[model samples]
Target: MARPTFRELTAQALSSVEHGYDLLAPKFDHTPYRTPDRVLNATVRVLRPYGPFGTGLDLCCGTGAGARVLRAVCRKRMTGLDFSAGMLDRARSAAPDGTWVRGNALALPFAPGSFDLVVSFGAHGHFLPRERPRLFAAVRTALRPGGRFAFPLAAPARPGTPAYWSLLAFDTAMRVRNAVWRPPFVMYYRTWPLTDVRRELRAAGFGVTLHPLSELGVRPDGSPRCRLVLATRLPEHSG
Candidate 1:
């Protein structure tokens, strides 16, 4: 966030979401928009047991943080796909060894069963709830039979807590901004509940499973702070 100056942030806020990302791409790594290294590291460790995966895909790879997970786990080719040309340029430059694809997540440009593993991070907020089914279907289609799609989801903060209020305020602000703005920047903090997401994934043909990311620890109630959603594309003959 600090990477973009006030003028730059204002410009992005006033622009459409896609163009906003394009504007922010060069300095995205220095901003909070970039996925944290810790989250990426934790994912690598958590997924190591589930993988020794062949080909891998990183969906909506902003600047290739999740590509590290693909690189670590996959034995074969690694690919990063994103809608933003500026972001894809940065990803390609940063991770030269991997393939960089510029395309929409809702309609992934790949053959069916193209990848053994697929991972996305911090991109769910951009998709409205109604769009999730299509988005997930694309991911499901891109994966091989028995391929796994994974991402981290945090437990909702308790009501009246600072985190809860902060997210509420952000969502409210976004709603108001969209209502008044010419082109809306669709970002929501609280829309993607785990139960709803799981249902959507299941509807899209994934067998959903949850793995608590122990490295991030649990909240006071002992619920994990975050858990990884491991959704597998079932094989044709599997019971």
Candidate 2:
């Protein structure tokens, strides 16, 4: 069968929330918006050195993109969690071998130290900056002592590029949508800056490190275009 056109995919991705993804669910695997296999491979490569983990959790595991990665890195079991039922349904179908739980990232249903490793992909934009502390805390509680939470962060778009303008416009529109609409969608591409994220991670008890995803290549300024943030929880301080 032929691939769905970009127009069809965009129409589904941008239209009604559930219907949009419901339409895109099947072809989501074929889209570039899905984290590329190369990125996933690199994540596994970087995480393998730290792993041989018992259980892993994929936060906001949209369409099971990172769940597949977690399955490879995790030695025992993998679970994918997300808030959207539609997305979870698709992810469950795609990854029937893995566990799928539908829940908000803010209030993860897992107990403290339940997982040995936690990872997320392409979903941070769904969270606001203020929510990072709670989100990080939840993830921290979800992992065992010294367990790591990792994700890839792309370089900020250059100021003059179309990507930059598009992100600005999208954020503006989302702000407008939230102002006028009830139960906002709340996704913004520009809100989660890396510097702020690092501070938030530290505040939430993670000792963070950045590893360059060198295969993605560097920017014109000689900095990595994409890098992974690996945040490891420190051993709990006993009073």
Candidate 3:
């Protein structure tokens, strides 16, 4: 895929999230926003020991990057769902063997106990903090007892660092843009803190654990640069 031009990205940034992704779909994999192969490979390697899962779902699966991970770990079947039809179209072509469905993450269209493993990649920024409870509840409802939900959460950049300042600037600019714009493009790097996420997952009936993605290496602080969050759905009877 060719990289989107400056003009193209500017157009996308101005459009609504769904319309923006639709416009960018053809060139999405070439964008930096696409989940890197290193991340996907690390996720697959770390998840292999837990799987050979019966069925899997890739929530908000954009262009099927997570589906590729699911393919390696899931035995029975894999499904990818996203709200953007254009993304689902690209995902279908990229991984024709897997099932692709168009749906919102806050209200997953699958039945209760539909999957044994659910994974998401690079789609959290699309959701707002207020929407997380409903989003997690939907995922929990879609997973069977003992099913797992996994996603990578990177350690936040230290204050005063270039990366930290850059992310802060970008988020601030987005807040200003959304303040004046209609149908905001909600992608903030700092909103989904790991602490809040863990609390919410436990509240939603998932027992959460963190596995360091050591392959991605550690930060200067000796913390893993990224950790994979594995949230298992607790049985109805268990705490």
Per TM-score, the best of the predicted structures is: 3
Query: Residue-wise lDDT of candidate 1 within 138-203, one digit each (tens)?
Result: 888899889999999989989999999999999999999999997999889898999999988887
Off by over 4 Å in 3: none
**Clash tally, candidates in order:** 2, 0, 0
Write candidate 3's Cα lDDT for 40-117 as tens digits: 999998899988899999998989989879989999889999989999999999999999999889988889999999
Candidate 2: worst-modelled 10 consecutive residues by lDDT: 10-19
Q: Tens digit of lDDT per residue, candidate 2, span 104-175?
A: 789999888999999999888778888989999999989989899999999899998999999999999878
Which model is ahead, 1 or 2, in terms of lDDT? 1
- Greater TM-score among 1 and 3 belongs to 3
Q: Residue 197 deviation, candidate 1, in Å?
A: 1.0
Best by lDDT: 3
Measured on C-alpha atoms, candidate 3 has an lDDT of: 0.92
Model 3 residue 199 CA deviation (Å) reads 0.6
Badly placed stretches (over 4 Å) of model 2 are 1-23
- TM-score-based ranking, best first? 3, 1, 2
Question: Which is superior by TM-score, 2 or 3?
Answer: 3
